[model samples]
Target: MSDRVELELGDLQGGILSAYGKRGFPFGRFLLFHVNHPAAGRRFLEGLRPLVTAALRWPEDVPKPAATLNLAFTFWGLVALEVPTRTLRSMPEAFIDGMAARAAILGDDVGRNLMHHWDPVWQVAPGRPRVHILVMLNAAADREGRPVPELEQLTRLVLALAGQSEGGVVLMEGHAGADPRFQELAALFAENPDGTRTPLPTEHFGFVDAIGDPVFDGQYPGRQEWAKCIGQGAVDGQGNWRPLRTGEFILGWPDEGQEVATMGLPLDFSRNGTFFAYRKLHQDVAAWDTWVAARAAELARLWALPSLEAATATLKAKMAGRWEDGTPLVRAPDWESWQAARDRLATASRAERLAFLTAFTFADDPDGRCCPKTAHTRRANPRDMLDPWYRDPDPRARRGSILNDRRRILRRGLPYGHRDDPSGEHGIVLLAYCADLSRQFEFVQQQWMGYGLDFDAGNDMCPIVGAHGPDAKFVIPAPREGQPPFIATRLPHFVSTRGGDYFFQPSMTALRMIAQGMVDPT
Candidate 1:
């Protein structure tokens, strides 16, 4: 399946990955630490942070002193301890209790919060005892070529805290996305002190060693320009935020008002912060591929095209409201409109552009006629095209109208795992940047992915990544200019949301404070 890519070593967490082979539990955590320098990161993290410790914060208005941190956590939440990194063999009774306690905290959400929601089919998977620790550093280093950070040292700390023995197993994981810095780090790690890198597999479809970074190069100055208007209304001299100019909903400037500092807790209060969500979703590759093949057939029939390209064109046209080549179907249903919206979304005020896209036209009716409500892009941001009938009754109405959208997220994750590995399932780690996780990322998942109701109402889940019934059957209603909507039926599941969790990415200032052990939660 196109979406069911291969899994690679680069994609799998370095520690305890092999345990999955026997369905054995491998507990782990992915951590991103804000470090003042590589030296500081290593020295401070030589031992695991205790769970009883207070949350830290950076000081106000202070950017990180050139270091930052983020962490990914995946453990059974059983046999809990207050200390970090407990090993299986050496795990103390206290550590086991800590794990158990943490697991209990997570289970509390099982029947209540969508945040706690997991596939009923696979709750047993995580229920198995395991821990996967993944960490990401998203800040510029004090200087490159600092003695490479030791993965083994960090692992040992975690094992010690968990009270597990050395043979208990642990892996230090790293990713090389499209980013140059990450590439540098991966290159360093993939090689030994003698300077030889791991051999690239001829047929390896797992994660590649190519590094990808999350920091945007600021080639697009719009982010800086838009920062000024983030809190203030997007308006002219009259001060009325114009619908023609900006989107209906505006988040305004990020720094406006007496907002809580990034490090309001035990950390410095001066740095910026980013949130993260992590998951260790296992893919049943064989099953996913089978579903993809079956779904492709349905797509072929729906678009009346024999090739994937033609079907993709129809799919893209309906979802983007245009084609990949950039044609707006509303203006020229058959042409591409990549040019119109691309630069505009990156440059124009959010509201100004959103209004234009959401402006309904008689030429393309969305009432189950043109774009399906569940299309990926459509579900992410409905562009005010959701059926009015369903709008009022939206279970998540507190998030407000989707027409004038806000809380746009910037995606920077890279594809992981193997591209052709029959043994493993692989895809992008799927990272995003949003002003607020609750307002933006969480909203999209809950309303669109979980609810699966969009402009068309009671339609199939999103064509990509969205879920539907246990059978995983899906369909995309056809979009003929004047003809009745043609339902492309019986599509199979391709991109399954294996599993993930939310995280808070602290700025450099926060990292320094965290190292100093004085972070305060905002």
Candidate 2:
């Protein structure tokens, strides 16, 4: 019998299963709306339902759609839609409180990341309307990264619906620093002289992004499923790879805990649904470039590196736990190895390249010699580093990676604004989806990224996204004998929160119930 878990594709939202930017739809626009009248809100949803894309597998015979749309509702949105009181109270407290309310716990209340410093749309001033609904539209981009005509048409339609005087839904403004209307997102790309664009996975910081996203059952099809899950999914003590339980990401399914958690009353209302943490994170490229340059100069002298360029590259790789091109440090522990790996990848097949990038273990580097324990990628996903019995002589007594399976989150979203503008409105619209917000998303953010206890790094936060100040530092351990560890000091905040919120992305069934006013919970 096959152990594969079949997902309810038609019932799930497309955004949950697929990262549209990686699937050829790279340009995106996010619009926030405030629902004033429940009746009008339902009417708007009913009209918009047809445009919402489902998580159905695309047929190989047909061309992919030029644009895709998805929807998510805040807790306030459910209230605005007049959902039953019982259902409202049954929601997870973290979602009920929302991202802004939990800012301190998330380490977002300090410095530029404070809620007051966020975009005007996220600032809930006295008598101002709260963001209720979020409509995400993704469209295909041209070779030059410009949006296709279809995106404008779809935008017009959505604007028309929100602009109707009696529609009772008002569009929220001041989200994008460049436009002050809707947040525009686009993946960074390289243009070819032949009028074709090659999407570069790198973010504004010039490092490749989204390299090690979690893989779970039913995420891929057939043989590709297990193949893709290698090193990206749960691992056993015997060093075997397998997909994580579907419930880790989808609702009403068994998770890594081997049981389904309590859902909102009336199973259908919450089945196949999941929670999302929408975050607008602004990257300070100027600060990042300046800091890395100065640090690299000092590192060149300390480490006796060849040149400033090599020192800068090594410095970035040390902090990121991978080379800028997405090669894991475990696979290429030094500059020479990184260069060799790059050469191999230059002629490797796509599948072969992926394995080189992700198929590696941190068990050997327990002391973090190859990759710093506090490196951004290492902190975010420790892999086997968190295993309690990893150091045990008896391999059978070890717990490989059970501890991290529950904390994995599906990352989706794309970079926004121009990459050339160092001080301009530029950042990533980070979207994280998981069955439980506190367990998966919040835990990773608070414990892994914000704190340093798990990695034995003593309050030293992740250098990439962690809140930093003059006292902040990241230690890079030297593997060779007689070489002292290099400490990069006086770290600056590389990334900061601009605006964000918690949202519940419902299944198609739940959406229908909401639109039809059949969400009864007695």
Best by lDDT: 2
lDDT of 1 by residue, 75-124 (tens): 22211211123222222222223222333232223222233333231233
Number of clashes found in candidate 2: 0
Assess every candidate by TM-score.
0.50, 0.97
Name the regions of candidate 2 deviating beyond 4 angstroms: 60-63, 165-167
Off by over 4 Å in 1: 1-43, 46-134, 137-271, 280-309, 315-332, 335-365, 368-370, 386-407, 470-478, 481-484, 520-522
Over 1-522, each residue of candidate 2 has an lDDT whose tens digit, in order, gives 138887888899997877887888888999999999998898888888999988887764234788988899999999999989888888899999999889888998898888787888998668988999999999988756688988888888888887773759988888755777899998888888988887778799898889898888888776566898888988866677888888998988899888986567678888899998999999988889999999999999998988898899999999999999999998888888889989999999999999989887788888899998889999888888788888887878867777798899999999998767745688899999999999899999999999889989888899889998779999999858899999999999989999989999999999999988998776
**What TM-score does candidate 2 get on C-alpha atoms?**
0.97
